[model samples]
Target: MELTDLATIRAVLKRHGFRFSKSLGQNFLTDPSVCPRMALACGADESKGVLEIGPGFGVLTKELSERAGRVVAVELDESLLPVLGETLDSCRNVEVVPGDVLKLDLAGLLKEKFGGMETAVCANLPYYITSPVLMRFLEERLPVASLTLMVQKEAARRLCAPPGSRDCGAVSVAVSYYARPKILFEVPRTSFYPQPNVDSAVIRLDVLPEPSVRVKNEKAFFALVRAAFGKRRKTVLNSISSGLGLEKSEILTALERAAVAPSARAEQLSIGQFAELSNRLEELKNEQ
Candidate 1:
């Protein structure tokens, strides 16, 4: 159906009486080449199952269905259901699920839709909900093998950024801990039907079998990471002490024991360093 064709898209929307929802970040991809490239980047093959979020107009869904054994697309906007039905009519392997991915039972959905298959996520994510969606993807620890997502260029940078880089944030740390993120390519704003203000990038995150760093407590590890990045300008020791309600002296002692400099900023510490610091602090707390 050539879903990425602007004229075809316009005609379908007009026929379905579908109006874009600004609040929902409804920028549909109109560039024909982008979707195929994104699908290729996902490494989807006849053996793999794919879960797509926000399949606006089903352009990416169509591309994915061509390569993957099964494609389950979850769309939040019900108005697009008819449009997707029309666009994806010939794609027998595609399933259009209507629901908020954030609220859905992802584990159950994966088990039901993609059982006994190597699964992956490929989506042109809504920019506003990118962080939370990525967090949910990682935190839920879904059985998906990888995620190749279209996100804001800046966000892609942050997600794939190294721990000691300026672009690194709490999310960056979390992403690094859980997956190996890399920016595949950038998409110009003109790539969309209604051009967005900022450019987008395709990022591929290969989920690790286990986290990159080992710590005694995952909750405590994440809590320490959040506190480290809570106040960017503050020293890691001060930030952890204040954010975690630990004594500054105790934090300093833990830092020393972990071989981390007290003056080091969160941005300057590696994931291993954070794990070390977190473990030392946990030990000190247990001792007291």
Candidate 2:
């Protein structure tokens, strides 16, 4: 079956009496060129196991199966299981695991399905759950080596944005701390069955062995990052003080100790600087 063919996809969905759910952000990939590149970007190979999220019609799943030793896809929509089963029947290496990727115990799942094989993740992620999904994978420190995801173009810039750049946000800092991110390529709105309003881009994040920066407390570090970027318009001193509920004097002291200027914006600080400030602030809080 030509899964990327518009007519073929329509016929197949009709045969199964399937309907696209807007709430689920069901836009199946119609561009034949996309899946191959995404699969390659993640370095999917015979020695690797690839975990896929939202395998609409098994288009990318098939591509991964061809390269990886095994492909396990987590599909949240139960209705698509049958559709995937029919489409992916020929691909003996592919397994359609029906569940929410966000809720699943990924470490357990990877251990069970892939055994000791090197693992990677490839997905055309829904825009609505992009940040949460990516964060879950990163925060949990999953065993995956890399993640190749298709996300909104604007989000791609932010996710791959340098920590101290103007495009940087709390998520950008978190992503930077966890992995080395790069934008691989772009996918236009015309590539999907039900076209979206905006264009998309494919990005690859190579998971780091250790965090980009070390902090005394991961909880306090993230809290400070969120607080810093919480009000981008404000100076880092003002924002961190307001967001962390610390006195201006305390925040100023911490910033000075960290060698960060009080007038700097959140976007002006690197991950290391953020970690340094977070550690200093934690020290002061403990002293108090």
Candidate 3:
């Protein structure tokens, strides 16, 4: 049942009569070493409860269960449950749950499976659903200590991007608000079976105890960020004004009050500046 190679994986799939579901993003990892390395990078150990998304064939689950105290491996495909159970039989620390990760209640899951233990997440994310999944864990208020996932190389670059770069966007701003993200490793396309056409990278996101910026009405702050970056090529003042429906003069004054440069583009502004702009906008509203 070892997923060290495609032949074994195919054998296990056939033995269980499990058909791969492409719609669920079912590209399984064939690399023998990546699982162990990902587990180690996640800082998983006997005290940690690891949340695994899409544990196809339980190859990574085996390594995670070995290193982590408990593993709540959520799989979208119920067809793979029998296969995972057989493959991960020896590991008592593993629990394979059948559910769509997006629809499942993460907080409730943590209470039921992890209890009071701190946790980390490790997943070989489906390429098509990468952004949504990453946003769910990082921004949807899951109480995880850290997140380590394999994402498309292009996505990893955009998520962890710095200000003033072409890759930087609303996601970068949103992600930076909650955690300090870093690229952990680059993985070649060959690592996965049915090899993907593009390269991928592993990123480690260390959750911050407090937001990078302490702003009044945090939700509004992100709303403002979304507005600012809504039109990438537009000037900061123009985009925010158009997106938020604020007067150009008011937007300019708020930008100035925030101590942001007048000519700055949304892509050039840091997360701190976005927070400052939110605070300034509130002040402008109060003054009126």
Candidate 4:
């Protein structure tokens, strides 16, 4: 069956008595070209294991199964389970697991399903849960080598944005600390069965061996990052002092010690600079 075909998808949904749920962000891909391109971009191969999220109708699941040795697709919508079963029947390598990716024990899941093979994630992610899903992938520090995701266009820009770019956010900095993100291509809103309001872009994040910078405390480093960007309009000095509940003088001193300009905004500093600032702040906190 041509899973990406609009008529076929509608027929499958009708046969299964399926209805699209806006809350679930159930937009099935209708573009045959997009899934193949996403699979190729993911660099999936016979030696790798692929974990796909939100495998609506198994279009992308089938594509990944063709390239990877094993594919485990996590679908939160229970109604789609049988539909996936039917669509992915011939793809002996693909397994559709019904559960929320956010709540799953990813490390355990990876160990069990992808033990002997290198792992990667390839999915046309639900826009509503994009940040949480990506955060789980990054914060867990999973063994996955890379993630190739189709996300909202604006989100793609923010994820791949450089430190000083206007598109950069706290999440952008956090993502950069974990991986090298780049936007590979754009998919029009019309590419889906129920077209989304916004266009989407395919982004690939190659996981780094270690964090981009050295910090005394990982918690303190991310806390500082969150504090820095908490008030977008404020200078780094102001934001840190207010967000972290530190005296402005103390924040200024830490910035000075780190050789970062106190006048710089959070977005103006690179991950390394933030690390330095965070380490200096930690030293001051210890002295007090």
Candidate 5:
């Protein structure tokens, strides 16, 4: 079946009585070239297992099944299950799991589905839930080697931005800590069946074997990062002091020990600098 064919997709959805859910951010990809590129970006092959989220109409699922050894696609909307059954009927390697990817036991799912095969994730993610989903995968430190995702073009810039770059945000820092992110390509708003207002871009995140920077406490490290970016206009010292409820004198001391300038804001600090500051602060707290 030509899964990307707009007419074919309409017929399938009509037959199944499926309707797009606005709340779920349902925008099915109708561009033939997109799925192939997205599937290939992840470096999936006969030796690899793929975990797909929101396999709308099984378009990308079909492409992945053709390239990867196995594919487990998790769809949040149950109404699309039947639609997928018909579309992916001939794909022997694809299995559709009906549930929210965020809530699922992904480690268990990957273990059960892929076994020891090298795993990766490829998905045309919904714009609204993009950050939470990406964070879930990164924070869990899943066994996957990489993730190739389609997200809003603006979000792509933020996600791929360097830690100290102007486009960087708190999420950007967190993502950089876990993986090396790069923007692969862009997809126009018209590429979907129901066109969206914003253009989209594909980003590939190569998971690092170890974190980009190591700190004494992972939880405290993230908390510190959140605090740093919590007030973008404030200096890092002030933001950290206010967000973490620490004394300005103490934060100033930690910043000095880390060789970071007190006047610098969160956006001016790199991942290494953040790590250094976090470690120095922890040391000062221990001395108290």
Candidate 6:
């Protein structure tokens, strides 16, 4: 809210004598308004519990504690304990847990924090752990309401990308299978104590119970999708052949049956088309 946040963040670090580590991506959001926007984008409810990752200075945690029914903030940097304690002390609803968010079983942690509370996630995430953190929640298959994260703007574009875009890769398809993504807001580079070179955005992902398609074998379907995008310039047939260790003729036949052109590339196929290809693969497997 004030320049004091930068000063307070620094003073807290000085009193405790802590230095920010570059490897950990330790950029703290000093602008206080960003927290409530994050909570809102995340759909934080007084009745729903939230798990936040990388609560560097707990600036966001302070805001979340007011809006959510319960807030469990996972902080990897132990250096900010005194800072977090000072900020979150008045807020009995917030509990700061010191641990690497990647190693923590998030769903299990949420349950432990407040049993039977509908869970959601809100975080000012570290850029280094972006993929792993996003994948963990997206693949968890838990009862989370949604995940609203502050990530690199580039990552946001990738997550919300449509088919046929440069950003549409394996991660894009994998994300689409889990939930619909939307970029809610863009954060300026100057908002942090030490401004990161890259700008960031707040993106929300509404978790789905299952994929939008009716595929028999979801695992194999995703494998096929990943394989298809493994090489961007290659045709679907060639990409899949390399991945599945099948011949070009075999891939062509499968594509023909699915009504997809073998000349098409991975990014050209929609989720349903991919499912269709997967179904045809099953038929081919059965025939053999």
Q: Where is model 2 more than 4 Å wrong at Cα?
A: none
**Per-model TM-score versus the true fold:** 0.98, 0.98, 0.96, 0.98, 0.98, 0.95
Question: Who is ahead in lDDT, 4 or 6?
Answer: 4
TM-score of model number 6: 0.95
TM-score of 2: 0.98
Which ranges of candidate 6 are over 4 A from the true structure?
1-4
lDDT of each: 0.94, 0.93, 0.88, 0.93, 0.93, 0.84
What is the model-wide C-alpha lDDT for candidate 5? 0.93
Q: Give the alpha carbon lDDT tens digit for every residue of 1-288 in model 1.
A: 777789998999999999989999999888899999999999999999999999998989999999999999999999999999999999999999999999999999999998899999999999999999988989889899999999999999999999789999988899999999999999999999798899999999999999999999999999999999999999998899899998899999999999999999999999999999999988997998
Give the runs in model 5 whose Cα sits over 4 Å from its true position.
none
Give per-residue CA lDDT, model 4, range 1-288, as digits (tens).
999889999998999999999999889888889999999999999999999999989999999999999999999999999899899999999988889999999899999999979999999999999999998999989999999999999999998999899988899999999999999999999998798899999999999999888899999899999999999899999988899998999998899999999889989899999999999999998999
lDDT of 3 by residue, 1-288 (tens): 566678988888899999877777677788888989999999999988999999988888899998999999999888889998888889998999999888898889988999999999998888888888888887777889998999999999988998888999999988899899999999999988777788999999999988888898887898898988898888899999899998999999998888887678899998888999999999888898
User: Residue 228 lDDT in model 5?
Assistant: 91
Measured with C-alpha atoms, the lDDT of residue 288 in candidate 4 is 91
Better of 5 and 6 by TM-score: 5
Model 2 is weakest, by summed lDDT over 10 consecutive residues, at 162-171
The C-alpha stretches of model 3 lying farther than 4 A from their native spots are: none
Instruction: Report the Cα lDDT for candidate 1.
Output: 0.94
lDDT of 6 by residue, 1-288 (tens): 232277777777787777889999888877777877887777777998988888877777877887889999888888778767876778899989999888977768877897998888889888989988898877777668788899999999988888888788878888888898889999998888788999999999998877777777878888888889888899999999998788788788889999999899898888888889988887888899
